[model samples]
Target: MSRRPQLTGRAAVLAVVVCAIAMSLAYPVREFIAQRRQIAELQQQQAKELDALRKLRDRGRQLQDPDYTMRQARERLFYCEPNQKCFVVMDRGKAPAARKPGRAPKPKAPWYESLWKSVELADHGVSR
Candidate 1:
């Protein structure tokens, strides 16, 4: 006949407590793993942003140099030497082939132009 070891009340209570602890820890372990993955993703994004910041800083430093500054001014601002004449070619709604160098048109008045009257009114002297 095989004899089974009988568990005491204290041992049964201890086993139940251990099982409860294990069950409670499971969710926290899974949540911790998910949070670690998210942290890695955020760190990767931070690295990319830092790299972009460094590249922009390098570009700013290059712009401070005389050659790069002069080149950028000439291209973007249409700047030339003092003796050289600068011609600005503009094309309106007309044909592009027949466009000539001229000044661009001015901006039109807004719809509420009458509301912005600023004429000097004549002041009449008040007699006491």
Candidate 2:
């Protein structure tokens, strides 16, 4: 009857080699899974971009109509036909007073004068 080979140094070394090869594959397998996840995320982003593009196309088609163009100009740009009086309503609380342009900035006082002012304030027990 034929006899099986005994487990010696060579067989032990072969078993260790097999185990090492399997361990080495772990990183590659993890990287493959990560790449698959990235592909799925990119596909979802592409779908959202395509939907936005469709909406923009629809807006472009709407703007091609003359009535829509005139309405948009009147509402957004305050455009009016010739000989028509236009009244702009302004909120009293938010309106700014008009100031004349070309005014130069005032010059700063000398450093010694500022230091003396601080000293005077300190002597009078002021917090500033």
For each candidate in the order shown, give its overall lDDT on alpha carbons: 0.82, 0.92
Query: Model 1 TM-score?
Result: 0.51
TM-score per prediction, in order, is 0.51, 0.50
**Local accuracy of candidate 2 as per-residue lDDT tens digits, 1-128:** 98877988899999999999999999999999999999999999999999999999999999899999999898889999899997766675786867679976688999999999999999999967
Point out where model 1 deviates above 4 Å. Answer: 1-18, 92-128
Give the candidate number with the greatest lDDT.
Answer: 2
lDDT of 1 by residue, 14-121 (tens): 999999999999999999999999999999999999999999999999978999888878878988979988776666566755545696667887756633332212
Model 2, residue 52: distance off in Å is 2.7
